[model samples]
Target: MKLLLAGIVLILIIMWKPMPSGAGDMWRAYSDMREANWKNSDKYFHARGNSDAASRGAGGRWAAEVISNAREWVQERTGHGAEDSAADQKANEHGRNGGDPNDYRLLGLPEKY
Candidate 1:
């Protein structure tokens, strides 16, 4: 009886769906890239002694472009592209709404009654 109970408990634990961590990790990586890009752009602009409003605007745009490129590269390398991010967001939202974290509906499937 104890062995059977233990088996059931283990199964239940295995079946439990935990919150996804990929989105958080992706966000952290993106933020890091953005910061690095911004710092590099700032240094480049400052080195050229071009701290005018136009220079600042150009630097910001360059930094954003670099971050976007880096994000796409990371996603392609990791096989977790924008679609995965969207699914993760949906699952996170569904979990916050009291739905199961692993629910199929979170993947945009029609819910079966």
Candidate 2:
């Protein structure tokens, strides 16, 4: 009778022991979720970095264009710019006609004639 009772207790202990299928599934699911979240975060940060670099390049190009336009506008308003452009054109034409390669007059320098 005592042996039978001990056998029943051992059987109950074996039945109540934790199983791998129960807690293991929960742990695996949690690990998969963590891995997926990490991958999503990495992709988001990579895309953000690419977008930031592209925007910085575009902004730099836009700033350069604005500065160029401003300088051209100021040169036009000063009055000397137009005259120099016209003189440069005329000097280029004269140099072409005379077949002169070294024409200092194209530089808008004062001529001593």
Candidate 3:
């Protein structure tokens, strides 16, 4: 009975993913940010990544939350300013909650983004 319950729980977790591409989405956003190298655009990328992943469903939202929190926690200790980290977290939350990432995007950004 215990084994069966565990198996059922595992199955539920597996079934939660509409697709297993959330992490990749997050990574792509990071890569794009690096490529863009646009000043003051980091918050936009953070929101975009979380929003992109969250739109995929619960699994994606979970991945985005985990990755965003972990990244910010690391950054807080790695010489990044407190204000910047706080703003980043705010952007991340905004996206995860279905807020439009474009709200954070800067004008004049190229269409390829």
TM-scores of the models, in the order given: 0.25, 0.24, 0.86
Please give, for residues 54-105, the per-residue lDDT of candidate 2 as tens digits. 2333332233233334544675787746765454334333322332323331
lDDT values of the candidates? 0.37, 0.37, 0.88
Candidate 3 segments whose C-alpha is farther than 4 A from its true place:
1-19
Give the least accurate 10-residue stretch of model 2, judged by summed lDDT: 43-52
Tens-digit lDDT track of model 1 for 60-79: 32333333345446866888
Q: Give the clashing residue pairs of candidate 1, or none.
A: none
What's the candidate order when arranged by decreasing TM-score? 3, 1, 2
Residue 73's lDDT in candidate 1: 62
Error of 1 at 18 (Å): 41
* TM-score of predicted structure 2: 0.24
lDDT of 3 by residue, 53-95 (tens): 8988878888898899999999999999889999999999999
